[model samples]
Target chain A: MTDHAPKDIDTLIELLAKLPGLGPRSARRAVLHMIRKRSILLTPLADQMQRVAETARECLNCGNVGTADVCDICANEARGNGILCVVEDVADLWAMERAAVFKGRYHVLGGTLSALDAVGPEELRIPQLVDRVTSENVTEVILALNATIDGQTTAHYIADQLEGRVTLTSLAQGVPIGGELDYLDEGTITAALNARRQI
Target chain B: MTDHAPKDIDTLIELLAKLPGLGPRSARRAVLHMIRKRSILLTPLADQMQRVAETARECLNCGNVGTADVCDICANEARGNGILCVVEDVADLWAMERAAVFKGRYHVLGGTLSALDAVGPEELRIPQLVDRVTSENVTEVILALNATIDGQTTAHYIADQLEGRVTLTSLAQGVPIGGELDYLDEGTITAALNARRQI
Candidate 1:
């Protein structure tokens, strides 16, 4: 509480600076904006954050976030019909969901296998994905990972592990090279999904 | 629910699909990811959302977001230097703060004076800004508004109103065309701030 740091603003700036692609400068701007839109964006966002902090949990079965364990998707009996789409991250999964296509379960890998980061299959949920394939009677596995080198590598590894156990497909070529699923438009994603090919 | 949404997965999918940039395919994928990352990303994200939902609020004075009525910045006696930096949005203000350059105070003008949206000064905090400038002994008014036509227009209007009463300046070059200050790098922002010329 010295003259150097304003406590609350400092805490907020630190938190904001940790967000992906945000530096100190951007964090400050974001904080200021949230302050201005407090009634609209800031308040709502904070409320959502608090609610999420309190009640949100990861589905024990899948990696999706929800208000409860096993998540709504994993709890749903209708979605257990053997189709599982695997993604690199939650944002990617969310992107796929935005398309309003695909009627299947999901498995989030948390992140792709990065050689630079020393992320192997074990670091990811690859082992869990393999176990789920056998337990869920899955007929198809859609490798909907991103198009990055790491994403492709992770997808290939998953495909290898599930070889011959079930049908495997990946999203078609509408996704640009090095592009993340999170950045793609719904129409592009939809087109890619509709034209998916067997890997 | 019927076969159309016989499972919580479907319900979850419907909800997730409605998120920004997410579609049905991505929603299902995201839901799955959250389920798997229950203890990590999903749980934390949900909890954060909940927390933010409950505790977030606007700063009564500067329109910054915080748990209290007056944001941390607004309530701080040290930040009250009678020098108000006006910005189009909180994001811009946050950017300035991130640079840790300015120590005065802030006035977030929710948005620019947009003729297309029929937004006027009354619709924004322009009047509040003017009041703060006069009452706060503001030696200088930095118009850190965006580079957009509307942003510049708003800056010009404020400048004209203040006229000879205060030293007026705008963020200098290095800010890309139509670029929001929030998106600029810290060094670039610093350079721009250092090079700022009179408006």
Candidate 2:
């Protein structure tokens, strides 16, 4: 609520301010930049934002986000059969996708199980995953959860629930400690995917 | 468009894909992250985005973007005086503000006068600037143009137009060749501000 003309610039800054790493100050700076580059940056950015605001959606089955209901991986016929790579979130799913290895399908866990946060299987998409294993003819489940305690705990819980029903594996070591799939390079993600071992 | 469930993820991805530094792929990843962090990140981000999209605007006088029409800087009675710092764009104005050295007022030219691009005085709000100089009681004019050929040419033109009417000066010579003022650190900007010499 500034005492100004309040037009294009304010709309842009307000949008930018909601970004993960941006505050009011940074948002202000970013808005100014976009405005200055209106032809090359601002106009297109505005158009895209409007378009996306009207289009983006989540995959109901896999939790992967897309401009569709089921998402590409889930809908693709070429993806590996009955082998779902379980990920903590979509970033991990994207990391796996970027590798272009492991043509298998994916399952997004939404988040790790957290006792401190009182998270449980029901809180995540675990129940749906269990249903997918049986209904989709899934033969293997790769636990591509993050290496944090909560992530591990969630993985173990899922494994225990689905034990003996499907082959269980996890991404192999080489992922740096405290590493997030979002921060990993394509090559590293590929290597990790290729070398994935049974848990 | 993917072939999956709920269909909302599509809307989210389409919106996210439009963000800066994001493509369709990255947008999917980002949307997934937000969905996963729904309670923690997504809800708040969505709320903020919606709110901002509804309320942001620009300053009528200085062209500064804000939540209001006049903008905080222009509307402030404390900021008014006959000293106007003319900048090639809003980014330059922001950099000057970040340096926190100037206290008078600002005049955003929108862009420099570019001959190759066929940009002229009318396209850049130059006439409005001339109007402000006389109407606002401005004594000093700081030409904070970028260190580019077009920028310098525009600066010269403005200085020529205002010759004998006000004290005209340009930012000092430490600005790197072809470097954007936005890329420079706070210290460099501060030093540049401190060392600004007469044109």
- Give chain B TM-scores in order: 0.77, 0.75
Looking at model 1, residue A162 earns an lDDT score of: 90
Clashes of each: 73, 41
Model 1: CA > 4 A from native = A1-199, B1-32, B174-199
Q: What is the C-alpha lDDT of each candidate?
A: 0.70, 0.72
**Best-performing candidate as measured by TM-score:** 2
| lDDT of prediction 2 | 0.72
CAPRI verdict (incorrect, acceptable, medium, high) for model 2: incorrect
Candidate 2 residue-wise lDDT at B130? 85
* Most accurate candidate by DockQ: 2
Q: Pick the lDDT winner.
A: 2
TM-score of each model, paired residue for residue: 0.55, 0.63
